[model samples]
Target chain A: MNGYLLAGTITGVVVGLVIAAVAMTFTKKNRKEKFTYDERQKTARGEGYKYAFFTLVIYNAAYGIIDMSLTKPWTENMTGMMIGVCLAILVHVVYCIWHECYFSMNEEPVKVLAFFGIISVINVIIAVIQGLHGELIENGMLTNNCANLIVAVMFGVILFALAVKGYVKKEAAEEEE
Target chain B: MKNLKLKAARAAMDLSQQELAGRVGVSRQTINAIEKGDYNPTINLCIAICRVLGKTLDELFWEE
Candidate 1:
C-alpha cells in the first residue's frame, strides 16, 4: 500500500510537470500573440476559485460528519488529499468555463457550458469507478489514473478543435458578407 | 444568415482585421471571426465597429 501511494505521488508529479512544460512551450512559441488575462479575467478566475474552495470545505465537513457517525476509521490525510484533488479539478473546470464565457467575446456560453458539463460527467464517472474498486492510492494516484489523464487531455483537444472549427466557419461567412 | 457588410466595409477601407479590431477595442481574432461570420458581436460591439468604419447598423448587419 505504501509503495502504491509513493508510486501514485510520483506519477502525479510527473504528469503535472509535463503539463507545465507544454504550457510553457506554447506560451514561449506564441510570444507575439500572447494570451492576456485582464482585470475582468482575473476577477472571474478568482471568483471561480472561491466557489470551488467553499464547496470543497462544505463537502469535507459533511463527509467528516458522516464518517464519524458511521465510526469508520478514516485518516485525516486520506480525506484531505481526496478532497484537495477534487477541489483542484473543480477549480480548473470553473476557471475554464468562466474564462471561455466572459473573457472570450467570440465564445458562446451554451457551448462552453456543454463542454464543461460533459467533462464533469466523465470525471465523476471515473471517480465513482475508482471509489467502487478502492483503486485510489494514498499518494493521489488510482488504478485508472491513466484513463483520467487521457480523458482530461482529450477534453482539452476536443474543445480546441471545436473552437477552431467555429472560428473558421465564422471567418468564411464574414468574407462572403 | 446575418450579413457581415460591416466587416466587408471595414475591409474595403484598406484596413486590416487587426487594425480594425484595435480601433474597435477588440482582439484581432474577434475581428477575424466577425469578418468570417463565425461570431455575432453584441449590439454595442456592432455599433462600435460600424462607427469605426463610418457605417450604420442597418447597413452592416441586415438579416436575409
Candidate 2:
C-alpha cells in the first residue's frame, strides 16, 4: 500500500529467490559426504535455537502478563508486537552465524563486519538523504527521518561493538593456542 | 570417551584435523570436538574416521 511495503516486498522476493537458487544448487552437491555438518556446528545450532526459543517464550509470556494486568487487549497492535518475534529470530540467526553453524556462510570476522556494515551504511545513507531532501518532518518529537536516524545510529554502534568484541575474542583465542 | 586414540591414530598417519575431516567428509571442528571429548560422533562418522586412518572401531574408540 505504501513505499515501505513495496520496498520490503521487493527485498523479500529477491532474498527468497537467491535462497531458493542456492538451495537447489547446493542440496544435490551436498548430499554426498562432503564435510558439511560437524558435531560442533550441530551442537551450536541446537543451542542457538534452544536459547532463542526460550527467550521468545519468556518475552511473549511477559507481554501477555502485562496485557492481563493492564486489562488492555494486546492483539490490537499485532504488527507492533511482532517486532519482538523479529528480534528473537535475529538473535537466533546471529548466534548461529556467530558459531559458524549457518549454511555455507563462514564466520569470518571481516565478512561479519561487512554484512553489518552494509546494513548500517544503507540506513545512514537513507536517513541522510531524506534529511537533505527536506523529507524529515521538522517539528521533531520523533518524526520518520528522526526515527530512521536513531535506528541507524543504534545499529551502527551495536555492529561496531560486535565487530570489536569478536576481534578481541578471536585474538585472545589465537594467543592461547 | 575423549577418543585420544583417534587423534593419535590420525596424527600417526600425519593427517591434520582439516585433512582428516576432508577425508572423512566432516568439518575440522567436528574432529576437534571429538578429540576434546566435547561431542559424541555418530557411528557413521566414527567408521569414516577409522577408514581414513586405517583403524578399526575397537582400536580408535573403545576405551580400556
Candidates' RMSD to native: 8.9, 5.8
Error of 1 at A56 (Å): 2.5
What are the TM-scores, per candidate, against the unseen true structure?
A: 0.46, 0.63
Measured by lDDT, the strongest candidate is 2
Please give the distance, in angstroms, between residue B7's alpha carbon in candidate 2 and its true position after superposition. Answer: 2.3
Clashing pairs in 2: A35-B25
Model 2 misplacement above 4 A: A1-36, A64-79, A97-100, A103-113, A127-177
- Give lDDT for model 1: 0.60
True contacts kept of each: 0.00, 0.57
- For candidate 2, give the DockQ: 0.46
Docking class of 2: acceptable
User: Worst 10-residue stretch by lDDT in candidate 2 chain A?
Assistant: A138-147
Q: Which predicted model would earn the best DockQ? A: 2
lDDT of 2: 0.66
